[model samples]
Target: MGQDVYEELEREIALFLRRARAISKDFARAVHPELEADAYGLLIRIADDGGARGTDLADYYGIGKPTVSRQVRLLEELGLVERRPDPSDARAAFFCLTSEGEQRMERMRTARRERFQQMLREWDSGDAEQLARLLARLNVLFKTPLVDGP
Candidate 1:
C-alpha cells in the first residue's frame, strides 16, 4: 500500500538474486571446474530441451550468436556437449549433453534440490507451492517494460 512495501520488495529481490548467482557459480563449478555460470544455465536449457540449435539458444537468452558460439565451443572442448548436424538444416547443428555432462548435471541438480528441501523443511507444502507460483508470476512480469504502479 505504501512505498515502503515496494522498497522492501526491491531489497529482498536484490538479495535473493545476489545469493542465487553465488549458488549458481558453485553449481557450475561442481559440474565442471571450467564451467561458467552463464554456460551452466545454457547447459540446463539444452538438457531440458533434449537438444538445441545455436540460433535457438541465442534467441532464448536474448544474446548474440557469436556469444552463444563461444559458450558452445567451450562446452564442446570440455566434453560436456556435442554437436550433431541438423537433419533438416544443412548449415545448422543441434547441441546435446554428453553422457558425462548428463551425469554431472544430474548430481548437481540433486544436490540443489536437497538443499532447497532442507531450507524449506519447516514450511508447509502449501506455502512452498505459493512461493513458487508467486515467483513464476514475478518472472512473467519481468518480461515486459516496467511502469509506475497505481
Candidate 2:
C-alpha cells in the first residue's frame, strides 16, 4: 500500500479504538453501576473461559499480577465473580462468573449483536458477511507479527 493508504488506515484505526473505548465504558455501566470500564474485558474473559486462574488472566492480558488481583478483588466485591478451588491443585483457585454476572453478560452480548444487525440492516447479507470476515481477518493480522511490512 502507498503511504497515503497507510496513513488513512492509521486514522481509521485510531478512531475505531476511541469509539470502542467509549462503548466499553457505556457497556460497563450498563452491566452494573459500579463496574469499572477497564474491568469489562476481565468479566468477558472469565465469562468466555468458564473459569481462569489469576495468573493465567494476567499472562493472557499482558497485565501485572497486582493489577489483575485488584480487578479480581473489585469484581468479587461487586458479586460478579467468585473463586473455586482447582480440583487437582489445592493451592490454585479459578475465578468464574456468578449467576448474576453470567445473566448480565449474556444480555449485554445479545443487545450488542442486535444493535449490529440493525446497523447493517441496509446492507446486503453478502456484504455484511464479507465485512465480518474482513474484520476477523484484520484482528488475526494484528495478533500475528507482520512478515513483510515496515
Top model number, TM-score: 1
Across 1-150, the per-residue lDDT of candidate 1 in tens digits comes to: 999999999999999999999999998898999999989989999988888999999988778899999999999999999999876796899999999988887898799899999999999999999999999999888866576667
lDDT of each: 0.91, 0.88
Tell me the spans in candidate 2 whose CA falls farther than 4 Å from its real position.
144-150
lDDT of 2 by residue, 35-100 (tens): 888788898899998988988899777688899989988889998999989766869888999998
RMSD of 2: 3.2
Residue 146 displacement (Å), model 1: 4.6
Q: Which regions in candidate 1 have their CA more than 4 angstroms from the true location?
A: 145-150
Clash count, candidate 1: 0
User: Candidate 1: global Cα-lDDT?
Assistant: 0.91
